[model samples]
Target: MGHRFELHKDVELAATPEQVWEAIATGPGIDSWFMGRSEIEPGEGGRTRLTMAGHVEEATITAWEPGKRFADRTEPGPDGTFTAMEYLIEGRDQGGAVLRLVQSGVLGDNWETEYEAMKVGWDMYLGTLAAYLAHFPGRTAAPVSAFRPGAGGPDAVWAAVTRAFGLAGPVAEGQSVRLAVDGLPPIEGVVDLAGLPTYVGVRTADGLYRFLYSGAERGDALVLGHHLFADDQDPARAERAWQEWVTALPIG
Candidate 1:
């Protein structure tokens, strides 16, 4: 049986509606904040695609209104499962803009688990968006992604990750972190977002490093969705290095 669900979230950004529109409606813009590599075709009926780790998903644009609103819907699968997402942007008189997201979908047997995971995932992505607009507005970022399979539940996996980073306990926002991984130079940054087992984001001088727990069931227990704004960084190489780093972690 298929079950339907919808989620609503609103985020206020310290950016103009046009700026917010650019981030949501363009490929590079989306790449700066959201997961995976994304491509958007113009106008209503055009297509939107996201590619990650050799997996590709595409959706058709259902509504497009430039800086005002954008919406898309995925084709139904054989089990009658489909997903739709809508973003509404409204400028505030005092400045900035409010971006509202409405995501609705139909799921197969594991609806409850999938719904919970999606909820957590969206929260992390939206938080990243706000951070991007605040700290790296108008800058294009090269996206870096990596993932690792994991066992155990959320708490256990999260604990292992914290231990690998030498964190004593839960990650705290504003706390300092220094990374000296193999193949990469020393990285010094401060935590900007920390949401327990689900996500943690760090902001350095030129990057936003986001770590996500895509759920134990999904097999991608640890995911790195990073945005590097520095011109010297190569995304593909960074991704490979991070993948190696994640795989080598003592999380098992």
Candidate 2:
């Protein structure tokens, strides 16, 4: 038999199979959790292009059962090997579901060592996936953060934040909005102002922050403020509070 390597791990999620499948199915969804900007043609004989950090790989989908299973095969690394990966989702007796990832393939020399390294990588990645789904179920867009020490005062800060966050795409001045960041809960808020003399506050998904904003300053300094639930909350909660606060600020 050819030298083969396998790695498998299972995680119990607080989401339904359909919810988990959505995260892995859609292109942006896949990017948010696994790779970046995935081009997945669902169903048999379809193909998926996953951009890992900066590297890109092409894979073919061998099977696709909505809310249940997704399998793909891809050419190996630079050495021209090959790899097969599958994601299996099944409902549990209690509720929620279990997600299992099975990766198998032949190997070159040092196969055992390579397998161990990959095991760690997948463990971290899957943990990220789980955390993402648990917080923001069906959302998949990264938050934007920018800072401008001194440009045009409040007007400059407004432009900096808008440009950095990419909020120039037909957004109404006084409308409510929500955005999702990978591994973080969604942000809910409204655009308080469009130019100088502006103020905005966003209520986060986890209710950690009641408000976050940048003020119109007289000089080269702008003050940013973020309201948190409390200091004694979980570290994750506190971090999210600060992140949402920072992400909402304008960048220079």
Q: Which of the numbered candidates is closest to the native, going by highest lDDT?
A: 1
For residues 1-252, could you state the per-residue lDDT of candidate 2 as single tens digits? 235878898988888998888877667566444524578898978998875324778888988999999999986666656788899999888988999989988776657655765675565446546656765666664422222334445555556555534466543545566655445445665543232343333334432121112332223433333322222335444445545555555454
lDDT by residue (1-252, candidate 1, tens digit) is: 999999999999999999999999999999999999999998999999999889999999999998899999999999999999999999999999999999998988989889988888888899999999999988989999987766457777777766655577668998887876677767788889898778888888899999888775677478889999998997778888888888877654
lDDT for residue 22 in candidate 1, whole number 0-100: 92
- lDDT of candidate model 2 versus the reference: 0.58
Evaluated at residue 172, the lDDT of candidate 2 is 50
Which residue pairs of candidate 2 clash?
Answer: 76-81, 146-250, 146-251, 147-251, 147-252, 148-251, 148-252
Pairs in clash, predicted candidate 1: none
* Best model per TM-score: 1
Each model's backbone clash number = 0, 7
Task: Please list the residue runs of candidate 1 whose C-alpha ends up more than 4 Å from where it truly belongs after superposition.
Answer: 164-166
Candidate 2 segments exceeding 4 Å error: 1-3, 76-80, 143-252
**Cα lDDT listed for each candidate:** 0.88, 0.58
